[model samples]
Target chain A: MMRTPFEVPMDGLPDRVTIYEVGPRDGLQNESAIVPAGVKAEFLARLAEAGLTTIEATSFVHPKWVPQLADAEELLTRMERVPGVRYPVLVPNERGLDRALDHGVTDIAIFGSATETFARRNLNRSVDGSIEMFTPVVARALENGLDVRAYLSMCFGDPWEGPVPVEQVVRHGRRLLDLGCSQLSLGDTIGVGTPGHVTALLAAFAEAGVGPERLAVHFHDTYGQALANTLSALRAGVTVVDASTGGIGGCPFAKSATGNLATEDLVWMLSGLGVETGVDLESLVATSVWLAGELGRPSPSRVVQALAAESPGRRNVTQVPAEVPPAVEEE
Target chain B: MMRTPFEVPMDGLPDRVTIYEVGPRDGLQNESAIVPAGVKAEFLARLAEAGLTTIEATSFVHPKWVPQLADAEELLTRMERVPGVRYPVLVPNERGLDRALDHGVTDIAIFGSATETFARRNLNRSVDGSIEMFTPVVARALENGLDVRAYLSMCFGDPWEGPVPVEQVVRHGRRLLDLGCSQLSLGDTIGVGTPGHVTALLAAFAEAGVGPERLAVHFHDTYGQALANTLSALRAGVTVVDASTGGIGGCPFAKSATGNLATEDLVWMLSGLGVETGVDLESLVATSVWLAGELGRPSPSRVVQALAAESPGRRNVTQVPAEVPPAVEEE
Candidate 1:
């Protein structure tokens, strides 16, 4: 081996990152099939076993609206809570918040939209109206000594509105923070976020007195910009990221929507960057493979697919060994 | 709509970027099926029509090694070269260089490996021996007044070697630059590169007196980090990127390899960032779709898949519009 001069230094990077695994709630909610409560609980356990510190368990929503996660309460009751892991459920309004409290949920998330069109279409309210709806829920949760996270969707681009202005997203995001939500997750709901957009949004948020410490990033892989946007967010000083196992979930309304950023893919980047994520890559890959099998589909995540295909059992089926006669095999 | 304060200014970003379209050469070379010469020519023309300034036409390697691109000469002869568009071909050795010269090729690229394992497996030589083999070819091309590029493969990770040290990659890359190549394209051959690693390597390269202006980035999406790595490179001031149309091409020796960073995906990000790439995104998407049809498979690019599925003709086939009740349709 030839020795070389000069080593690459990892500079200006956060030493640790918090991955908010949303596979159980956000990922499954948009899935067509209704995963059994037991199966959902098992998936959470597997995620915890793989060393994820934060996992969104399920959502408190009307069965008539999101039939896939109607059994959220049952899953909460049946699931084993790991001692060090945090399981937050999505709560849309006061009624949902009440239901979550009834289920003994300690952490909760409230979603708001940055775009007026998405707010009206998805929540039957204008952007201001949706904030009005979330205000009471956030106040009640904060009073109950519960941690609340606010998710501001369409922070990048809106399908109907096209490219959203940054000022609008900042105003909407700050309002949610003012409502007493501890952290605000900027969401690239349609996955149209570019790295430059991410940096600009983060800068705008910073200018508004909201720093990375009080922010998280949630991205969709709709146009394959999720991971890239995540990288930009990380560089912008964000430490919290939201991702899905097996890259499941696409918006029903937006047929072009793909899954959230895959947890395996995020782990791969973090691991290579020497960032301390504390997540086991191989175990995460296995869990995604198992979930993909249950869904009766291949994982949309490139990492999961590559690792699964590399295993001995599937290797022969998918990949033929290189036919080069080993004329120069070196140890 | 509520009035808000703040604009996310695109600060410290390059105003323009150059995309090196490699679908015709690097992409097709790894494909299993040999694309017809006429179709290859058409693909090249389509890329140019989409405003790609630099297109790698084909590899001038022996037919036995890269049979998929064995029609290199035919492709060059049959294709209508767009004015102001540079079509470069990969030249493996002196013989390949002679073939390129015979065809009046103005631009040529030579590939070298950073890791010993890949060098032996892909080129049947050690890293040193591979560089030695390229010295004469690069010198000959430069002497003939042709623009030459050197592609340094596995700069980030190797299938067998795992994470290659940054020092090793910088040394190899600097040597290639010293060999009279105009540009050095750092390739993450196994797709294990993360944003942090890209920064670190670029920093190491800078320490070795190599600037981003003389560098291009080639990333694979095997682990879904290609776009993310590309973003990092762009942020690090690298203006040129290598991408494959329809996200074609996976390394043959590396079974876990996936497609190159899709040109459509790159253009989508560049456009969103307000960076000028001079490429028409819809035209690029159409070309990828057309090529996918010719290949008898769906494109691996998320942008191509999303845009194609969103069109009116394919809308009813892959996606069923949401059946949400009008009670919530406030928009």
Candidate 2:
């Protein structure tokens, strides 16, 4: 059976959207099992082959913090960069920036927190201190002619702090964008946001002189609100969305909690909405299925599971085209 | 950590919504394991305790067609109907209606199909033939002073015939509504719809003189588009949404496919949007967890799994109050 949704155009949405593929970085980071650098490189290649224009290759966080991506340098060296595709690496501090610069990386992203508790716990610094930490990193990355993207985590709610104020999130986000970052991807780190909150936050950003062009949304499916929140963001004029292939990540603290929204699921909705995403859903499902096999677990993505289960022969990674067809234009 | 989403009201939505809970009927109908009549009774009672006003109790289909719900009569006899809560039973034909009337059923639903293939396969009659068959059932129910709801399945797509036309669905829905049924529920049986399709379908219904007040939406989450579609429906002025507790009812054909949109997830979004549902999130989550224990399988709902994992002690079914506290008004 065909798995694609019927094309039906909606109003007040962008003609095209940029899906920032974060499978190799945000996805694998949560995995307890270590995937080899070769497999990581192959995964990046498959994502690019499946028509993703921007893929976060790997993060430069220390091995002690994220052992899964310890082979960041090795994976960058082994992987062949696809032409016209942007590969961004996460830089935690000056050291991570230095490593990214040394590898000739053209794009880098810095992670910040909207709440004080997450800033102290994740970065070992206060919210203001973390901004101070990123100021230098952003300035240095720009000096090297690298494009910078900033991630503001816990923008909606914190585990310790119930609900982060919309004003506080807008205030922190402006600071990150003020530090020469081209885009600020709002992160629902614990995935506790809904569509109304999403609209309010975007309105808050616009009120503070930041347009939707400079904003992105990154949501987790912990409470199954990620896709619905993404729809709200699109309706509010935001165009970039962050998703992981096969829905790979899960919060280590909350065992059953889902992490990032699955890229395939997002693609299915985008395709159905008649929005242009420049992605091939079938090839993307195949890539996720193959990766699930290497990880020895079934994918958490509904589209991946449904499509993979429908055609079990598609599970063979080798059968997937190294260079799949281009995205289908909706009527 | 609290599982309830922060209240953030959106513009242009109704102040309240009616969640038509179908866990006991549509949810259990797909289950291969036949639950005891007593357990099914307890599930209905707990749903009422969670503040769902309209709960579909069970299907009166013959045992040969649906063995899982063959104990429908016993279930209705064993369960105590809460005051002010409506328990609607599915009456397939005159025989089923007789059984429901014999047991003092004041509310009933009749299932029809929009697509010709689904109508033939599911009801063993053509689209028009099925409507003809339902004419007498709906007339009798109305004459008996029963509140009747008509379900038009395969409104979005059919597994055998893909991408059903919006006009065909609207026409069939009008016929069902014309049969003295108070409301017509559009069902996306295959879960292959997006926001744009939802908006277009509702608009078509309006053009055909059926207002949103008389329309309900029942979406499956097979492809992860249910909540997003629901968001669109709400924006298009739909006030009634169908959901199953614990997200049960996987398609019998596809093993990994999700069945209905989980009620807890919908409540989370509605609560966050400042829309009154009269459901307590904590109590609802506990109910889903308790039901999961009886089924010996984890819930497919992200909200259920997250809350259950957050508070391990909440898994004790006995701890859930037989009569929980009333709904929290949004401030």
Candidate 3:
């Protein structure tokens, strides 16, 4: 019965929201340019200052497949980690996790796909084989007293396999949960899943003994359903959401998909809903803008641009077509 | 209760989601290129093919303000009025509405801002003063048996006035409702308002005898919260939602606010949630892509990029610097 000072309803409001920034690893992995280790270090530091408590900083994958993140160890070592924040890195196998453990990383993540075709195409493994691969990885990571996150890719659908079944996502989710993954990140890898798919997938997981608290939702705004799909997951009891800065990181295999949801944009969403993420909207946008600039590009987060709107004489009217005559400047 | 093969938990689903496409008018108004009248005609035709039944075709504002949409007359005259569809054109005043009516317009939308500063800056009047201006316009349009729609801009907040009080929005919304506007399109002009604000403002409207049934939402992705805000509004019983193709259209006065919610993305959200927008994802993405070329830019709709992933050989990876590069190939 607590009413806001304005006497507005606060139905279904959450106490805290977790924002997982995937920009450093997932976002930077597929980019054509190799971000300087120092540039990425500064990027993470800026995100930390903006109040991002959990950011996926780097991946320990073979540099051959993802040359963009080749400076993972150097970047992580150089960045100043905030005291209370968690910085998890992606590990494809024991070798990758070994590299992370060597750096004394307390939080680590493992990844697996749901479909055989997707697993083979994206990860070069069979469906069952990928889980088998993670079993030992998860077990060893847990024994070291490290928190583990498992990313279950293609929970929505696969390109080779048109419609992803809810049961398949549930089975794999439970596997990750049973294997001692502290949290499960369900991804619409291709941004093809709708809210219906999200609800069904989550319900299936719940029925299979994994509830909302153990889940995080990751969506790519490929078809523009990422936020909507995230909302569906939240209504079903998810509190953890993962996004990339400036909407960075497109699935290399998913031709139509863009970046994961923009962290700046996601923070805008969480802050606007009265859901506290402990992040400053202005600072988050500023960080995104700076990152886009370091990469020599405009920030994809629309909120960042809008917040920067009054930049003295920024002149939004695009450059005059060279052929067209110019108009007099407004008085 | 209803169930679908889409795997949605039918029990938790919201019923009857509606979409409002402001693409033709709002989407085209800010484009640099003056789309040929024929292309605009084809664009509207494609939107209908994608299952959007409610479309805002053109704005009858003075040519001096928006030279891009000066071909409003030709656009409406040649537009194919699809059966069972409601085509609404924006009318700024008596003259604007007169031209709209002259082109066999059966639906006309009149707009006024909720903030005094915005009203005066955008329309040269106070909030009450602007309402007074639209009263006769609304009355005249409704008397002519045209379905009248009223847009209330800055309903959530204003650039000039930070954090618009829910009370102010309610007062202005009630005035528009009282004027017999068949529907009200509430706009978050600055992209500063979040889901919490949406809940606050919508709850405000409900208290003032306004039901969600007669409402539509228009959000800017300024902070990348448009979809999130739209989702909250939908949860509050709003069915009709406003969007633009490729997230096209930025307010000339409200510069820096992101484009309107992309129609392709909006449709993706609804269809996935099993809310039934009835839009074909492929066709919708196709239309958005076509329009992007028409505007000589990449679409702001992330889903359009994602849908292209389903096809082979082509990908949307080219870095789109804010301004078109001189050496960049056109088309």
Q: In TM-score terms, which candidate is top?
A: 2
DockQ of 2: 0.28
Tens-digit lDDT string for candidate 3 (A1-331):
0001112224665567799888888887755457799889888888888888999888877665567777888877778888999999888787777888999899998887776766765566687777888788889998999999988887776655657788888887788788999999998776677776777788888888888999999887665667767767777889999988777665544433466777766765665556678877667766767776666656555656665554533443331111100111121
Model 1 over residues B1-331: C-alpha lDDT tens digits? 1111112335666889999988888787776667799999889888998899999998877676667777888877888988999999888788888889999899999888888977887778998998898899999998999999999887886656667898999998899999999999998766667777898889889988999999999988877988888877877899999999888776454433466888988888777777888998888888988987777766788888677766634323233212111123111
TM-score of chain A, every prediction, order shown: 0.91, 0.93, 0.88
**Candidate 2 — which residues are off by over 4 angstroms?**
A312-331, B312-331
Q: How close is candidate 2 to the true structure, as a TM-score?
A: 0.94
Ranking 2 against 3 by DockQ, winner: 2
Which of the two, 2 or 3, has more TM-score?
Answer: 2
Mind giving the per-residue lDDT tens digits that candidate 1 earns over A208-228? 899999999998887898887
lDDT of 2 by residue, A1-331 (tens): 4478989999898999999999889888876568999999999999999999999998877676677888999998889899999999988888888888889899999888888877776777798988898899999999999999999988898767879999999999999999999999999987889999999999999999999999999998888999999999999999999999999877644555678899999999999998999999988999998998888777878788777777743332221110000111111
Query: Each model's interface RMSD (Å)?
Result: 8.0, 14.3, 12.7
Which residue pairs show backbone clashes in model 2?
none
Docking class of 3: acceptable
- Give the range of the ten consecutive residues with the poorest summed lDDT in model 3 chain B: B321-330
Clashes of 2: 0
Tens-digit lDDT track of model 2 for B48-84: 9989999999988767667778898898888999999
The local lDDT score (0 to 100) that residue A254 gets in candidate 1 is 49
